[model samples]
Target: MSKKRYILSVALIILTLNPIFSQNSPKTEILLVGFDHLGQMDNGTPSSDIFSPKKQKEIIKLTEKLRTFSPDQIMVEKEPSEQKQVDSLYKAYRENTLKLSEIEYGSSETYQIGFRLAKMLNLETVYGIDHYESTSQSLLSSGKNIDIFKNGLLELMNTARPMKKKVQQDSLSIYDYIKTINQPKFIDLSHNLIFNLPAYVINGKFSENGTNTVDIGKIDEKYIGAEYITLFYNRNLKIYSNILNAQLDHNSKRIFLIMGQLHIGVLKDLLEANPNYKIITTSEYLN
Candidate 1:
């Protein structure tokens, strides 16, 4: 082939391969910020009152730090079905026509963190990516020799109680408390509490009374503590799906996900597994 013809052929090949190569590149940087429920919503976990002026000021400073990430999208732990309602409120808030505190929205991290950050960044709207699934406690009640499971759960709560109390009693800022909870040490401990509770039952920790024996033949049919953990996993998976469904183009789109602290562990695992995303820890930005 002539030199001119060869050059033209090379250019066409590069054009054809550019998109394929780019597709393999990670374009989305996601900062998964695990936060406590500011509204005190009942999740069997301790809650805080974030509506005070001092707390509000702290939140603003925290948002300022997060703004350095320059996120293009902010995702909150609200249900996907509530996106329209959230968007409406966000739009009003951005226009300065609606005050979030006047409308019973002050207690939620969604408004305090997500909405505040979006406004500070001059973004249009915040995205809600929450999905709810009820984890039935009836399983705990039904098993014959389930005292082991009950004891295990109580131990787990007891383990977490001090940290919860410290946050409230020590007068730590909401940002500091969240930063502590999202640390790798805390995340791993939390995961162990959830997974180990069920494992205790499976390992026959309650078998001393002969009442703790789970029917091996009917294991799949019966409800167990592990199933409770699975429910939480499923919920986080659905929330991740909602995050993905937002359909942001994978080209350097920075996503900030503000969610309950417990969710951080699972969501981090899921996001880390995806090639399209690069996970950013709260420590990286908060510091």
Candidate 2:
């Protein structure tokens, strides 16, 4: 064989013999956009009205920017149980037959970011990947003397308050603001706030027994505060499972997830450990 033909023959043999090369597929590119809950997490502070003309214009620009990712699948913080209802709502929004703000929890970031961008991309549906079981609050209230490391948590929030105020004040456009919070620094800060709660341990550590009893102190061995925070973390883990199990096309290469800041850090940590995924940060495309 000629020199060129010999090299081509060698390459063909390698390609045919190497199962690794033959089986390789594009790594799924996932962008987890950490977002504010609009109002649910506002903690008595009302979020700026996203419904205003100025904010609406900013949202349009933000959606257009995210369109660059061309995600084959989009996930929201909503519960999977709401999937059917949200699909109908998304269809109504697409057909101009309904306004998201008219219904309950309609003005959530799921609609503002997930639904808005999905529609802009002309995608058929969005995925819901949240799991909510409200045991944290009850744990806090169940104990007779639940410390909650109250001072530490308070100090943490007080420190974060200024930055939170600036973001909520509309000092920056929606696009810029989302970019700001989704930064790795901010995501870490938001996540660490809850870890303080686990330090409020007393005697032995235990999770809820689901005995229909309110007083956990009666159990004799209870880690009220640790269990409180554990419940929150448990919910996030379930959310992670939902993301992994979401039904996407076999050929889908990109997934865009929009969820609250607290959940993002945990999810990012979980996703980065998986070799099948590549975590695309907000700074990448938004810039």
Candidate 3:
């Protein structure tokens, strides 16, 4: 009834609604689904290709379930060199969404699981990993110090060359990816392959498994055992930290990360630390 009373009441109402408004605002949710390798089967055991009939069907089913979360954005680990290729593949798929099932795996070497998922969900996708295509060229071109990478690659090539049976002309530096990752076993494997048979090491750029080869200096026969053991356990935690930092900054309501099982150990640790996120496994979706 009184002017002062009315003003005070209005102020209270505004304060109450502010929190609600803020809560409803758009935010980012990042889902990372890491597979062992683009495998031949749903078990993720080196499927022929992500778009294989079986793989597509499984992905369709998975998408149907992931759609329940209504993710705002999807991100996949794609190399920059592959972006144009991915775009072309996506263009072809978008042009022929109907025949996607019948298309062969090689139809578009660029398209993978994330591309199809984004297409099915009609969501935006991003290539998160900072990979360079001509890392050697880039290193040579860099104005800043390049020895870290240049020398690293040279040393890696020299040490690993002996091991490689036949080297491919087109190879990229995996040190960038490997350095970002902190897995002991992966490092050990890289070390072993680089030192023992460098030529066969290819590009040293396997997804999370460290199956690919990038040159690293000789592995100390004695230290190899300890170094790998340490890396195996440590890699997951480091990756978890990177993922957390990337995801928490967004306004995503439900985020899924597809990563290797080895990374699961790290995710477990993260879920324990952050109470806000509700971690659900693929099996949980089955139920």
Candidate 4:
């Protein structure tokens, strides 16, 4: 009788601990791809000058690998309007609106890659953010120059701005960063790549004369680099939280988010939110 009781007690203890442990540990596979650029159009081929063809091929191969898990949903960094445009096309599979062949150069690559994967896997893609048109329309209504703002942002990212490294105490949260930077007024801040560089560049190239570092006036590269790094760290925290919440809200079993490398850096925070999913990357499963 004592022996039976001991086994029963152990079983009870495990049952109790299981729930707690399960809550603390979740498993979700997050495959993060760092694309060459975030331009508005959809390009079939990635720029070898910017990111190598080898890397681009690897990304596609990784996309194929994702099919094995069979993701039910995909979240993109594009605005709602753009997302809708693509979603509509995918639903119809063909429309006069835009041809898959029409997508070329920098802007087109994102859609091509995303839709290709979606079609191959038959997953629903969700444009997880507010529409750019809504934001642009609001800005226009306020008599703000949307063109200037857009141009400024494009210039900031493309022009060689020297980034320096330094720890900043400001809130690292994406919401806080956007608020602190007053990003609504700045159109460029809307995109993830411009805002989240630190997380994406895993093997960060030392750029003394790169377009990304063009804006540092007289300030040493160290400070500029630090500012850029801080920006991404905070942005990643905010975005990861958003993605986690979205996944929970939708009650999705498998979700694959294609964002910059930087945002996907916070895997632990992401896993904590969705504690029942397995977290893996293209690199991990592929090579």
Task: Please tell me which predicted candidate would have the highest TM-score against the true structure.
Answer: 1
Error of 1 at 202 (Å): 3.8
Kindly list the per-residue Cα lDDT of model 3 for residues 200-226, writing each as its tens digit. 222222123333223433543333323
Q: What RMSD, rounded to one decimal, does every model reach?
A: 7.6, 8.1, 14.1, 15.2
Clashes of each: 1, 0, 33, 40
Give one digit per residue, the lDDT tens place, for model 4 in 129-197. 311211111111111233443454465445312210000111122122212222222222334333443
Cand. 4 TM to true fold: 0.46
Error of 2 at 15 (Å): 20
Q: What is the per-residue lDDT of model 1 for residues 16-88, given as tens digits with 9 covering 90 to 100?
A: 5674334555458899887667766323433344655666777788889899999989889888788788888
Query: lDDT (CA) for every model shown?
Result: 0.70, 0.71, 0.42, 0.45
Candidate 1 residue pairs in clash (backbone atoms < 3 Å): 145-211
Q: Is candidate 1 or candidate 3 better by lDDT?
A: 1
Model 1's C-alpha root-mean-square deviation from the true structure amounts to 7.6
| TM-score, one value per model | 0.76, 0.75, 0.44, 0.46
User: What ranges in model 2 sit over 4 Å off?
Assistant: 1-23, 40-47, 135-152, 196-200, 204-225, 247-251
